[model samples]
Target: MSQPEELLDESLRAITERTVELANPGSGRAVAALRRLTARRRTPALPVVVVGEVSRGKSTLVNALVGQRVLPADRTVTTSTWTLIKHGPSLAGQATVQCGDGTIETVPVNTVAALGTYLAVDGQQQLEDLHGAGARCVSMVLEVPSPLLESGLQLIDTPGVGGLRATHRQATLTALAEADAVVFVIRPGEPISASERLFLAEASEQIGTCVVVQTHRDQTLKAKAALDADLASLTDRQQWCALLGDQERADRVVAYFRDVKGISVSSRNALLAQDEPPGPVRDTLLRSSGLQMLTEVLQHDVVAARRRVRQRTELQLVELVLRQTRDRTRETVALLSGDAEAARILEDRRATIGRWVAHGGDLWRRRYRAGCARIPDELQVIVDRRCAELNTDVGRQLAAMKPTEIEKAMKGVLGLPAQVFTELLTEVDTKIAAAAAGVRELLERDGLAQQAHQTDDDGVTFERLGDGTFTRASTNLSVEDLKHATLGGMAGVGIASSGALVLAHAGILPGALAAAAAAGTAGGAAGTGLAATAATIAAPIFWPFVVGAVAFVAIHQVSRVRARTREQARTVLATVREEIAGTALTRALDAAKEVGRMVEEDIEAGIRELHDEADRARRDLADATTLTPAARLARISDAEDLLARVEDLRAEAAALAGRI
Candidate 1:
């Protein structure tokens, strides 16, 4: 079992440890997030700071509680610096203060108040210079009041706001932020002044408690009555009850408090009347009305503060889990996209491989046929030469007609149907436009609207976006549009015109001339052979020669047919290339476009995981609590599921990258 105060102290310690873990420099996200988390109700202590008009005894309260008059309380701007008094194990300990020069000064306990003096005399030429320097010139420290070591609370004292001569009001406001609870002290009959109300609203945001105190109640009984009456006059009775709380309405011109015991006393008279001063004068006075009431109220305030701190810590943990889940989801989506892109690239290359095979086969066949086809044309040219050399009338007519026939054949062979090519290219244009439109939609999905390739009046152009996607207008396929044309037309002309010329030239001589040549060859005319003329003409050059001519004509015919075949083959090849390229482009675009969708999907999944983990962690945290000093110390450990969630988020990131 633990005491009430001890339990509170243990809870505070646990909160601080958690805060430290969240602020750890080793954790990238946690370190950055700590500022946002801690900015909201991070402190665990009940801040009780005393404030009053100049020479109205603000530091006196601090000195009384500390059981010493060590704090300067003279008439001439005493306690010029903002001093922070909090509980610690030792009175003299490490204190960190931000000096007026934008630097931190670590000093001992006693010299903490000297920060203002140091800046005023040693560095700043005048009080005005302090205003120019800002909070960097101010110092922060955990001033250990030995009396408060067992109290587990803090007390802050600030200079007067209304009558502190030549001080920056901003500086006073800045100093006031260090306190969690403020005791606003006023002279009798001053009833919640306008300045105090304004101060309360501002301080309420930074500090947890806002209390009003009317000091020097014993100055006059009449004055005490007047104070109560004036408070009623200044504010609506109902509102006053709200600010001061319904409990403290009985006390007039006393050490009044909200939600805690209030007391009134003439402390000055009590101390002076005692002939022998107690060894600890400050301690004796602290037991008096205002200070004693302040302590009691502080204890109550500490309880509420602890609850607020716990709630805030829980909110922070939840936010951390949500953010981590979002990040993991994004990573997973990217991984999937990358994997899909890789697969698409492989598929595209395979298509190119198929095209390569088709084109190579066509070229091989065309080359093989070309040689055989050339023989007939050459033979025909030789026969024409022999007839022209004889200068016969028939030979002359044949020569003249041959040139015209050759010319006509050339014209006919070269003429190609442009309609077929035009239609094919138009089809290509339509399909390309469709692809472009589809890709644009995907780009827009990824919030990459700028990457859309445009076909607007400015002409077709590619636009690039942030996500590494590019857009281009569909290419046209005119004679210039022939990005993938090859050897089809040339093969057509060679086969068509050359074969016709060879056949025409071979049949030039009549059958009677053919018979005379055979007789001459059989009689061995001119000793060409031991055979007649007919044998000479027909024997050596007989069926084998005819066969050779026929083979040449066959090759030429085959070559002519291949001309159209080549064009069709190239068209097929182009279609194949387009299919492969279009598929790849579509896949890549799909992957890129779907990134946001993937992220959304993964985030939902991560949220589910986080919900489960958080529930487990909350249960574990509750179960681990024994609410005893020994047990609390032992069980105050990190949530098991929280640690696992962090690991899970990391693993999710890796998995996402891999899948992509």
Candidate 2:
């Protein structure tokens, strides 16, 4: 490669490496496509596409350019598919067929006419046949030993469709999109059609260089004059004239074309005299055909134009990578910081849960204590009534009762007050439900109701009581009776329901009553001893006095036992009430704390994930920035020396173009 070509390759290689790295880091589909494009630069092929309407001698022009009878050139629509002709040691051809299953078949090209069987064109098979047969021709490749092909120029002979059919127009436009330069062929006798003009306009936009070829100049002289007049008129238009610029430049262009008759050529005459000896006839035909001048134009001006296209394409690819990298970096940074509105919403939720834990605790404590205060008095009344009934039963049956019957009667009286305690506990559960409702109301007012009830299959919801997370229905305390009330289970009851009360156990009343009864019986024995001592002190004179003292002692013992039992029952009931109230308040407070903790953790995790993504994006941006065209140029050793060498090479190429 020449020095300029080597430098260009170095720059493109640097870009391709950087693009591959970005794609490796999971940059999406656009980056992958860009990588493919950059890789293609390593063996860059400049395509010089030949395009025109059907029967315009485009195939003949391609064959003439290649100096071979390789391409099929006939009056009929012989060139059906896109034919790519490039340099090789010997003449060879191949066809690539795309099958319906996405498989491809690479077959040797035996004859040019076989292409019509796979491709669709005028006078060939229907276009739909290719689809129906589950196969279609993609492209035909021709490798020939031609000097022009060996100069790194690939000639493309595109099918002529006149831009009328949508598929044909698309195929033509696609070829144009990939062309570095274009050769538009027109017959001398015919005027440019609207479709041809449109094709030229679009081709001009995609390709930097375009040369028009007017074929069949050996026809009638009058037709040739009319064609020249048409060319002059077309050249006057700003669209065509702007390509030549000011009057001075226009004059130079007109002078150059005057010698060649406005790029008018006779392919027929040129082909016939290819092997003829040098004589007046050969010289005159060659000169009038304008093929020699067109060859010089392609060798110099077209080659420089192709180089310019390569440079521009490389520059565009670099810009695209930089733009995508910058955009991704910005997006990641925004994610790390988070959305202002969503962050505010999370903060508000945190603050609300915090406030509920603080103030709601005090409110719940007050409600709980007030509701429980009435329980002690209600239980005392039940105890007193049950004791009176027991005393009456003992008075009526004492003389005839057995020891077992008296024991049974005493146990029955102790158990009667259990129902009263159950009622008091039931009332306490109602109060607990009300307190939970208060918590729900507070959360709803602050827009945290949804957050509180959002539960996953693991039952990890915003509202946690103790061990279990509760929904609105399950949190209700009143829905079922408490089977085994414990401090922990009571704490687990969520306060999300208003109408129900959840109790751990209804057995709290019976258990406490049994213990209180046992203590009352022990105290009664002590009271009986004290009463007997007092009775003995007052009576001490006779047997009759002793019997009366015994009866008095019995009555006093019963009264003392009943009084102590009543006092003990009241104390036990009071302690149970206080315990229930305290537990309810503590669980509510804990539930609020748990909710606050969960919210904070979720927010922190989101921020952490965003920060990780941002860090990766920032690193990628740094790497991409380092590989930019300017930065890559700076990194090259002895860049200034190499650049000077490249400039000299470019000057030489420009001089060659000027001479042509």
TM-score of each: 0.33, 0.39
Residues 1-660 of candidate 2: C-alpha lDDT, one tens digit per residue: 678766665655555465444422223323433433343345647777888887778878887777776676673324235677888887767765444343445566654455444333321233224433334445567788888877788887877633322223334544554456678788866777654654554354334466778787777566457667756755555534443222433443343333322477778777766766889888877787778888888877666556655554444434344433433333333223333432333344344444544553453345434544454454445445544554465534654666566545444443333233333333433443343344434433544332223333422222322224332111111111110011111211111010000000111112222222222221111222222321221111111111111121222223233322333434433333333233322332333233223222322232233234334444533543456656544433333333334344334333433322
Q: Ten residues in a row with the worst lDDT in model 2?
A: 496-505
What does the lDDT come to for candidate 1?
A: 0.35
Query: What are the Cα lDDT values of the candidates?
Result: 0.35, 0.44
Q: Write the per-residue lDDT of candidate 1 for residues 1-660, one digit (tens) a residue.
A: 347546544544454344444332212223222322244244445445666566555565565556554455543323234455666654443333233443434455444354333322222222224332322222234456455434546565655553212122222443443334466666664445433443443343334344555556557676556655544443454454433322223121122223222234343433333333556764554454355565455455443454543333333333343333333332222222233442343333233223323453342234323432343343334334433432342223333454445344323332211112222222322333233234334323332233133222322133343454433211111110111011010111111112111111122113333222222221113322212222222211111111111112222332343322334333432332332233222332232223222222222222233233334333433343324555544332332233345454435433332321
> Could you say which candidate leads in lDDT?
2
The alpha-carbon RMSD values of the candidates against the true structure, listed in the order shown, are: 45.4, 42.9
